[model samples]
Target chain A: MAKQQVISPLPGTFYRKSAPDQPSYKEEGDQVAVGETIGLVEVMKSFHEIKSDFAGTVTKFLIDNEDAVMAGQALVEIDG
Target chain B: MAINVISPGLATSVQDLGRPGYYHLGIPISGGMDRYALRAANMLAGNDEAAAVLEAVFMGPELAFTQDATVAVTGADLPPKLDGEARESWTSFAVKAGQVLSFDYLKGGARAYIAVSGGIDVPLALGSRSTYTLGALGGLDGRNLLAGDVLPLGAGTAAAEGRSVPAKLRRLPGAQAELRAMPGLYWHRITEASGRRFFEDTWKVALEADRIGYRFRDGRPLEFVERTPPFGAGSDPSNIVDSCYPYGSIQVPGGTEPIVLHRDAVSGGGYFMVGTVISADMDFIGQLQPHTPTKFVSVDMAAALAARHDRQAMLNEIRAMLA
Candidate 1:
């Protein structure tokens, strides 16, 4: 199967979980669904959900939690 | 009603220049963050310069028009799409009835202003249509537009399409920004060496940048001069007796991060303000994106007033170009 990637739509801080105390939205090898929020991009204090466009299994994350991200940057790789 | 909200983007709110004179009552002057962009948009759409417009941050709203209208998007480089076809920013365009208007991903800047022909007709609260979401005072129900909400439009003549604001007239932020600030308020609280460090350091906009204020990081922490705490003031060196925080005040708490108060900030606070970003540069701060490199350039009163005059002159030039 080919792999796909999810990209950030805005430039800001990227978080894998909803909050500091929450569990990761997805783990490696976890199944993913289209429109499922994998993480959040916080820009100018507003949080925007970064949803996966391709449904597949979580292969790897390109960025770590609480990482600063730029728009159009690839975030995670998924195996479809 | 003339427009229907399909998707309210991230934070779409109705705003004008702002409602001043009520700060004494704890009401903030909530308005569009980029006042110059808002004015230019209104001018391009043939509305009064201070007419209410929709301010979308980060993302653009998906709106459906119930009637034909002239529209213009300004500020950010977010491209407007009419019925899935792309349109230019800073230029007036026409939207037919039942057409859905969306946007491409943001290219640069932060917030975008959408101005319609007749302006948004949300009932005025305190002589302005701006929304103060914290106090729930004005704008459409004192909140952002939500999906499926229908907004009424005031009656006005629409301008011809293709009216574009000149490139030079657009007030977009560059790759790096320098904000001219005048040291005042509690500048004495910090040691002179710390003041020099503050101006010399290069800071980046923190994630806490918003309507209320913008926090900066990566700069060296400030060192405060030793002093005994006054009554009613907290023991922290960065604390003072509760004081009115002027707009554009640069407040630093714990002698660490500096927060520049913007349009929707609280009227007063206990934090000691080290300085104030001059009035002319406040609009520039609104267009800055998170993580942008920035520096503080210290200036005196004479230089601050000169910059303000230059800003006003630029506004006049824009007004003429759109006229």
Candidate 2:
């Protein structure tokens, strides 16, 4: 399997889950399909979902939760 | 001549140049924060200069056109994408029915404008279509566009689409701005030291900055000239007799954070207005983002008028190019 990266579409703080105390959108070894939401990028208090483009199994997140990210920044790695 | 709201991005609202004559009735001139970009987008979309456009703040919406139409995305580098393909800003493009337009993150500036070939056809209240959400006065039921709200469209003017504003004529905000302000009104109430400090200090925009007002954090509390409270005025040190606040007026509440009132701010208030940002600089100020450093430069009325004239001339040039 080839490892592909899922990138954030916006510059903001990346969150693994919708909010704290909630289950994460995706976890390592979890399966995801194209257009499946993996996380969220929050900018200026607005939260936008981060979706995966490749159908694959989640490998690992490149950045940690609550980290400030730039546009097109790598968020997670998916094993396609 | 219709659009389906797929994902109404943050606070997407219908706005135009706004109704200006109703301020005395406590109605604010609620319009696009970045009017310069709105006008340019209208020109590109072949609409009238003051035609209604979608004003997206902090983020952009995902809109699906119901019919083939021309559209322009302008202001803030939200980096719009059509059907998942990246599109250009400050330029018009054609949208086929069922195609979707979305945006990437904001790269520069604050607000992003989306102008359709035919303007957003919401019913106008008080002679304008601008949304005053506070009053629920105008626009699509006088509120922000929500998902599933299908907006009607009007016939556009004959302005050619695909025309672009020159790179030089485009107004984008920088990390910091030196906004021109006219100091006076209740500026007398401000202590001389604090008054001087305001011009010298570079203040950062607070997180609460929005269409209503932009509050700045200068780290220094402003001191006002000591005086007894006037009738109807609260007992705050920055208190004043309630008066009409012109758009872009800077009011310091609690003598701490200074807030520059924007399009959707209250019509009048009892707070002291230390300065009024000039009309030309409003375009610049409107593009300021949170955390952007800003300085206020005081200017005379003549200079203010001259700036306004220059801005009008530049708009005319863009119109001439589009025409």
Candidate 3:
């Protein structure tokens, strides 16, 4: 099995859930499916979904919730 | 015919060139932040240069077409998609009724313009369809687009598809940018060194930057010449007896951060305006992203007017090419 990391497509603030009160979209060791949004990256006050392109078990997130991130920064890891 | 809003991306609103004549009446000429890109998208969609279009900030709205129409996406590259399939930007594409148009993450630039063949059929306010969100005037009910809002479309012809702008001609937004400005007005009120340093320092775009004004991160505090406060002027050296603020006016309050008033800025203020961003460079200012390192370059009036002429010529060239 190969491990892949989901990377931020743009630079902005990263949030694990859709809203502050919302639970995490996916948890560690959870089975993730393709096209599933695991988090959101906000830029210019606009929220953009960070979708998982690979289906796998969630290993862990590389960044914390609400952290400022850069483009190409690894956001989450997955074991496929 | 109309387009149904599925999800209104952060602050999606209808905007055209703007309302200019009513500024003295306390109205801001709120319009497309990046007029060049707005016109580009409009021309590609075969609409008039000043046709109302959706100004989508970094993110774009998910719109469902109720009728077949042609559209062009310009300005910030939100990575537009039609029916989940990637569509080319800075160009026109026809979408059939029921096809959903959305966007991927922003690749570059700060805003995106979506111009449909027939413009958004909002009634004009003061001769322009531009939205002034501060006053809640114009656009669709004078505010940002909301989910479920059905926008009526005007009747117009569309150009052929695949009308792509040359990459060189497109905007290049980056972590660093330089904008040209013409100094004067209340500039002499500032210490000579501070005025010189203003142009030399690289200021970061503050997070609060918006259509009304862009406040840059203060790298060095500016110093103003001491003078007796005029009758209505506040005690601060930066305060002037209230005066009219020109578009792109750069004013400083508290002698620190410089705020460059933009297209939607208020008509007048009590602050000392040190310089004005050249008309041609205003579009570049609109494309600046937050935290970007920005610089101000001082230019003479001759150069400023020359740049304006060059921009006008470029618009003409674009119109002829698109035709």
TM-score of 1: 0.95
Q: By lDDT, who's the top model here?
A: 1
Q: What are the per-residue Cα lDDT tens digits for candidate 3 across B134-203?
A: 8989998889999999999999986788987777778666768988999989998999999999999999
Docking class of 3: incorrect
Worst 10 residues of 3 chain B by lDDT: B166-175
Error of 2 at B303 (Å): 1.8
What are the C-alpha RMSDs, in order, of all predicted structures?
A: 1.7, 3.8, 3.9
After the best TM-score superposition of candidate 2, give how far the Cα of residue B60 lies from its true spot, in angstroms. Answer: 1.4
Every candidate's lDDT: 0.91, 0.85, 0.88
lDDT of 1 by residue, B110-181 (tens): 889999999999999998999999888798999988998988999999999999988887888788889999
Model 3 — TM-score against the truth? 0.87
Please tell me which model should have the higher TM-score, number 1 or number 2. 1
- Which ranges in model 3 have alpha carbons more than 4 Å from their true place? A1-80
Which pairs of residues have clashing backbones in candidate 1?
none
Rank the models by lDDT, top first: 1, 3, 2
Q: Which candidate leads in TM-score? A: 1
A25-72 per-residue lDDT for model 1 (tens digits): 999899999999999998765788999999999999999999888766
* Pairs with backbone N, CA or C atoms under 3 Å apart (clashes), candidate 2: none
TM-score of each: 0.95, 0.85, 0.87
Clashing pairs in 3: none
